[model samples]
Target: MMEEDDDVTQGVLLRCLSLYSRGGGCKVGATTSDEFGEIVGKSYKPVCGAQDTSVDCFSYGVEKFRKKNNKKKNFQLQEPNHNNNEMHVFLPDDILEMCLMRLPLTSLMNSRLVCKKWRSLTTTTRFMQMRRDGYYPSPWLFLFGTVKDGFCSRDIHAFDVSFNKWHKIEAEVLKGRFSFSVTSVHDNIYLVGGCSILGKMDRNSSKTHRGVLVFSPMTKSWHKVASMKHARSKPVLGVYKVNSNHLTIKSQHNNFFRTRQRIGGVSDVYEDPHRLSVRRVSRTSFEDQKSKQSKVNKSVKDCRRFLIIAAGGFGSWDEPLDSCEIYDSSSNKWTEIQQLPVDFGVVCSAVVCNGIFYVYSESNKLAAYDIGLGYWARVQTTPPPPQVHEYTPRLVSCDDRQLFMVSVSWCEGDGEIGRRNKAVRKLWELDFEYLTWNEVCVHPDAPMDWNSVFVADKNLIFGVEMFKIFGQVLEFLTMCDVSDPKMNWVHVSKNQVAREMDVSSCVMKSMAVVHL
Candidate 1:
């Protein structure tokens, strides 16, 4: 049942209990004598009847009243029936939020459908921040898939990493877009500009859409937000929070050819000028543009309260572009920061750990960039020894400033000299104090292709795999607990949702881990 609806029911039940607490006197409009008699009839137990206290009777009356009334028609929670002229319960907004915060996440999500007021109250930035601060809802991972079969769809799914439960989020608003950059601020997911279709278009074409869309999981709905001044696809999205204010930091994509086109080396075939854009979406309303503009200017002027950290990424042309820049949200501008070390190769992926940005490549080599001190250092860890065939290692960040490494290796079979991929989904935790990695546990028989990993605060890791095997696409969600020291990988969920589509054609368009 909807939570807001439950609020009304709870009010009535509380009033009924209060009446029974007062020795079952029926005041006018409080409850009819027949209703009081009926409640009394159900409250008394058969054998222990006369010996029970009035408190027990009140509790029983509450249960019976709830069961009886819930089966009836839906009641308007916000308004009391005027024909009966019964008093309705109402609480201040802050009190209401506090009461709502006690509910589980699933109940809170379903509460959005109760009314517009409930939806707005739960979806506000302030409410989301409160939820995070209170740790009301567990952390969840959102996965979005790319377009396939001539249709663009969000294909998004959510998983509660704490309870190992998969959930559904309404993502109709994310349709018709691919490669959109996704990042989370508190409990909301933001989708930036991307190609509306699969095909490539000219960079100067006006057909490109620079719109920004935001989805609040609490409300299970999406809404449009401020758009970027420049169209960006596959941009690096990061959330910069300073002094309790949030500013979305978007690092513009710089094509390797972007510099070449400027020096007259090539014509304007695919020219997307690289630049940074920072948008403040922490506000609940953007209707007052003039006042908002003034507020934005004031905020930008005080930008020195936070320091910006830049992480280098691989360029579009497969060239190693070591350049990086820092965006000062307060100043409403970006400054070119330190370039990566000269030997930094093509970055495969990156994650923030211990307030340091760690960039890793396909090889075992890694470089660390300090966000506060603005210093770069090559992280020294002993790489696995060379073999006849080498498998690329992947990194995942767990809770409590812990880093994990998933090492991949292969084995050769006998006789026919056939090769079999041996993937040990080992969970290794990094000890920052000692600058060492410790093997927590290993799943030696795990599949080679895990699409994504989500880490929970309890040291449980969720690895999801959606791929094809023997012409049949399969989806597998596995969970393992490193904190237990003896736990093995276990399958939590599986499916064949991509039965009609080839696995190779499916791509993960967007994915983000959010703390609810």
Candidate 2:
């Protein structure tokens, strides 16, 4: 559910009456019914006798009865009060379901087990009114991974934050697919490339599967859609959500509502007025501003293409690469962008925080990429003096307001395997805005060897894997409140996820998170 309201005292005052009476309880001794708006948390007040006080009387009676009932732990025959008129009343199943659906997502999920009716209401379309009212949440990350041990030749893992768990998705992949890459658009995570079932496994092979699959947890189903333009198993993919009107302005100064693109054709310009929180896409957004004196061209009206940038993979971290590409959802064309910064060794877990992309490197260095302006800049701060590289650095996004690094750190490095006294610090956080790093300390009682983790939902979680392999995980995710500068790293031990490359978890296997 949404966070608690500002006015803690004003809560939705629900009424409960005896099942026989079919009336509800109320707080004040009101003569008539009233609409309950606010949500209160603490103790309530008792109103004295007014017109019909049955509601309040019922409320008081139920509370006392419940408290007393909770005290009886042993099973024994108890005398029933035939005259007790304080039992809960049942409202029409549908109306009450609507009232329950209005609760926060968290509350609704927990309440599902209270009764069979509650469970059905929470999971059904009739009870899904919360989603339409914008009371539901934005789509979440789904990390992909393989279940069987071997070369990890499977593609069916996705993490759903709404369910607070991971899902193993079914896929139609080439036999021994081995590797794949993923990207996100709207609520769907696209599975793009992998070894084509009947093809060769040669280097950066064209044997990559060309199909794309999308999974939506709300409906809990998988659907295959169009394929990418070319066969690419490990290509980097980035998920960009832009408000067309606001994006057309090219500056964050404008006060426009956030817009989520409706699933557009791979070549079509994506727009959805129905999904916008507020404001509408005006004529200015679709026009090409060729000149102040000329009317905008009309070709855009005929066909619009939304861009999905894809870059980097399968070569030297120092490779002078510049063929950045965008998947045109409108035309189904995977158009390549010309001059992407080439010096940085881009990795999948890399993130654009505070306007710059923080990419960790094998050189034990942190590289920053300017996502909005397209430039590669090294984090000016010096790398931790010892210079470790074996273990992976999990990038936890801090208060991800605009995707700039609030902190960056890692666990274990490729410390000499046969050497003596090998000790690698597991985590660090660098506030990019401040150019500072603080090593986070794990709870003394918790596990120290963290394999992977990602930030989500204001909390952090760490995952597990045997041996030294990074386990071929596509994304690491968890919710964490990791932004405060004063927060102690000793308490910051964290991870949000791990999913296969084909089904993105974080960044929906965001390009930076995919072929890093």
Candidate 3:
């Protein structure tokens, strides 16, 4: 019965649109004699009366059809009557759905206010499915992090790829929590376990929380999902779609030398486009594999295979993990992979590229782990850092293929009478295929100290940082195109009236890109 009603609705809607496009001079089909088609014809009268342009005419026809169809006794209860003069509309629902799928998220959000029909269409499950299936453009970068004020904020800022603009939204439903990891599986952004921000003033007093959050772009809302079994602070998060209906989330807590380790995962099935039905999996699968550590034997150890260690004591706070784990999504388990060489003790950053994990160690060396062969090798082709005393190295993976290494260094140049110290940052792209690094120029005047939460997309990098400009505190939310010849960094947050609000509080913790 429901399918029949849907077919009737579609037929009536398309017929009204056909007549509307011809300026109502054309006749509708014989179905117009039925009650459903009769309401559609009556709805067309008010729509044509409100026509101001071709676009508005089509919109009015669709909106009117939707309004009058609801008045039918079989469909549902009747809606309030709309003034003919005020009947604003756009494309037919089916056509509107297709058009909206191509729009950037910001414009799609604004479209919700156009009329009742648009609002209903944007929030429907079918529309969200379209977004998940790559009908829309590439995802936008979303940053939820801390600023300089020491107060964590629930506010989030997003960068739209279509407009090249950044805008803010109230997203901290976890009550201003920070240190969480953000992962986008399909249409939703999952906020994994991180420390609570409800009341901690200092880092030492902060407490870790196991709460997991899921944000839906369609509804512009956040809701609680399944929490991790172990409380984690600054965990490493990764998401993989097992199939059309299931997702496997792997998260490692920041216990093993701040490098973190995989505890367990929530094997979730899709309950809807925005929500998941989560079930906790046991750690024993990964834990039991630890007992078979000796199976690798002493021969493999001497043959360039490293020993994978288990989590025991909390290593030094200042040290990085010498070991790392590999997550197998097919089995829904994590296995202790390999240990870093004695010469490579601490790692500054790590990223996965081409099915392999690459880590930048504190010793200024690159380590590569191949998942298929289950072994580690050092890459000598990594670009060397600048010859400066104070420097920080970061590894960023852009859109799952391009790998970039960003370095910020303090350089001192000899002056006429003294020495001047200036901050210099450089961008380098690493070609994994050929194992070569090419330095991409960053503008000389670009602000330094870009050591806050940052994200990289296809050609743009979005970073948020606090700086003191002429004794005034300023927070810069910036976007830069590394692929551009000029390598310009644009300040996206400068034009907003609420820019000061961002400076007063709001520190960015983590960033992720979502498709819609």
Query: TM-scores across all candidates?
Result: 0.61, 0.48, 0.60
Write one digit per residue (lDDT tens) for candidate 3, span 151-266: 67666766554555555566547555766667665557777656654563455666666566778765777787545434555544433222122222222332233232222532
Model 3 local distance difference test score: 0.50
TM-score of predicted model 2? 0.48
- Measured by TM-score, how close is model 3 to the native structure? 0.60
Root-mean-square deviation (CA) per prediction: 14.2, 16.1, 14.9
lDDT, residue 175, model 2: 36
1 or 3: which has the higher TM-score?
Answer: 1
Ranking by TM-score: 1, 3, 2
- Superior by lDDT: candidate 2 or candidate 3: 3
Winner of 1 and 2 under lDDT: 1
For TM-score, the strongest prediction is 1
Model 1 residue 373 CA deviation (Å) reads 2.0
Model 1 TM-score, 2 decimals: 0.61
The sequence of per-residue lDDT tens digits that candidate 1 reaches over residues 49-163 is 1232121322212222231233333322433455654344443577557655654455454344344555577778788767766866766777665444545655666766555
Quote the positional error of residue 301 for candidate 1 in Å: 21
Estimate the overall C-alpha local distance difference test score of candidate 2. Answer: 0.38
Q: Candidate 3: where is the Cα deviation over 4 Å?
A: 1-93, 113-120, 132-135, 147-150, 164-166, 210-212, 223-231, 235-346, 387-391, 410-421, 431-436, 482-508
